[model samples]
Target: MEFRRLIRGRVDEPQLERIGREIAKRYDRESVRISVLEADNWLSTPCVVDEEWFVKVISPQNALVQALFTGARNLGVFSRGEEGFFERFEDPLAMSQHELEATRRVREIGLNAPEPIEAFGVDEFGVLVLEYLPEFRTLDELPSTEVEALASELFSALTLMHANNLAHGDLRGENVLVHGGELYFIDATNVRKDGLSTARAYDIACAIATLEPALGANCTVDLAAEHYDAATLLAARDFLDLVRLRPDHEFEATRLKGEIERRAD
Candidate 1:
C-alpha cells in the first residue's frame, strides 16, 4: 500500500528487463543495462540503460507520473510505456499512441525538447527514449543575467506555446534547464491543450516564483513588473498570494514581492 501510494501501482522488474532487452535487440545494441536510480522509496526506481539516448521509466502505479505523461503527451509530447511493464495497471498501448501524436505536434511547433527516439509498451513494461541534454543547470543555479535572459526566452516560448493552444501543467524550478545560453523545458508530462490562457499565466507565475530567489536583491518584483504585462502581473500576484497563504512559503514570497515593489520605486 505504501509503495502504491508512491508509485501509484506495482511494477515488476523482470517485465521491465524483458522489454529493455527487446528494445536493445531492435536497436542492435550489445546489452541493455538497467541502473536503479531509486529503490526502497515511494517512487519507482528511475532507471537508465544503454540506447541511442536515455529512457525515463516510471511505474504505471504512480498517479502523478501517469497523469503527467498522459496529459503532456495529449498536449503533444512523446511518451510511451514499455512492454511487460505495468500492464496490469493500465492500457500502455493507448498511452503510447497518444504520446506519439503529441510528440509530433510539439515537433511541428519547433519547441525545444529532448528528441523522442522511440516508445513501446508491452505487458508490465513501458519505456520512452529521449535525446539526453548534457551540461545543463537548473534555473536555481544560474547567474542573474542568465536567469533574466532565460525568463525573457521562456516568455517568448510560453507565448508561442499558448498561441498554439498548449499549456505546460507543471512549470516548476527543477523542470527548467539552462544550457548554451538557452532555456529548455523538461518533464513536460503536465502539459495541457485546453486552457491556454490559464496555463500560460500559471507557467509565468511559476517561473517568476522560481527566479525570484536566484535573482536576489538586484532583481525585484518591480523590475519584473516592467518586463511583463498587466495580465501577467495579475497572475504573478495571484501566485504570490497563494504562496503567502502557505505557512512554509510566506516568508520567501513576502521578501521577493517586497524587493520587486521596492525596485519599482
Candidate 2:
C-alpha cells in the first residue's frame, strides 16, 4: 500500500469518555479509564485502559480505516475464509481477535508481547485491549549502543520466531517497543503462524530495512551477520537482492551456500 503513516492526533474528551463507556458496556467491565498512549501509531490510536491494559481504537466509518482494510484485502492478507477475515468495515472484531491470537502465540513461543485482554465495541468502532507496558520506548529513540543491542536481540527474536514457524510480516521499527532490556512486539495483526519460508525471509528483510534508517545499513548488516548464522545471513542477503539486484547475483547465494556446506564439512 502507501509507504506512509496513518494520521494520529488527540482524541477529544467527549469521544474518550464515550470510548471508555463503550468498553465498559461491551466487555461488562467497570472503572475503565482511557488515555492516549505514546503517539505516532499508523492505523489506530492506542489508549491506556485503567493502568493495566491498552486499547487500540479504529473507527469503522473512517476513510483511513477503509483504505487500510482495502489495502489489506488487495495484498491478500485478509482473504474471505481466513481466520481474521472481515468482509465489512463494521466487522473489525474478527481482525482484532486475530491480532490478540497472534500476540498470544508469539508469547507462547517465549517472546515478548502484551497479554491480550479482549476486543470490545463502542458504537461503530472497535477496540483491542491488551496488557500494559508501563515503561516502554520505541526503536527510533534509542542510542547507538541500545540500537546495536536491540539489533542483536531482534535477530535472536526473529530466529526464534522463524524456528517456531512464525513470521511477523510487518517487522518495522515502530512495531517494536523496548522496556529495559526486554523487547515487546506490538501490531501482531500481520504475524503469520503458518507462513512460507519466503515470508520468513521477508520478515528478516523488513526488520533490516526498518533498522537501516535509524542505524546505518552497513552497521546493521554487520551486526546481523554477527548475530545470526550463515544460513540466516544468506537468507537476509537474498532479501536484499530482491530490493536491489547485485552484480554478483548467482555467485552471492552460491558462495554463501558453499560456506554453509563447508561449515558442515
Best by TM-score: 2
Clashes of 2: 0
Best by lDDT: 2
> In angstroms, how far off is 15's CA in candidate 2?
4.3
Per-candidate TM-scores read: 0.68, 0.71
lDDT assessment of candidate 2: 0.63
Which regions of candidate 1 fall more than 4 Å away from where they truly are? 1-16, 36-46, 64-103, 143-145, 189-194, 217-227, 240-251, 256-265
lDDT of all the models against the reference? 0.54, 0.63
* Residue pairs that clash (backbone atoms under 3 angstroms), model 2: none
For model 2, how does the per-residue alpha-carbon lDDT over 39-68 read when each residue is reduced to its tens digit?
Answer: 555556778877777788765434355456
Stretches > 4 Å off in candidate 2: 1-15, 25-31, 61-90, 189-195, 227-265
Evaluated at residue 108, the lDDT of candidate 1 is 66
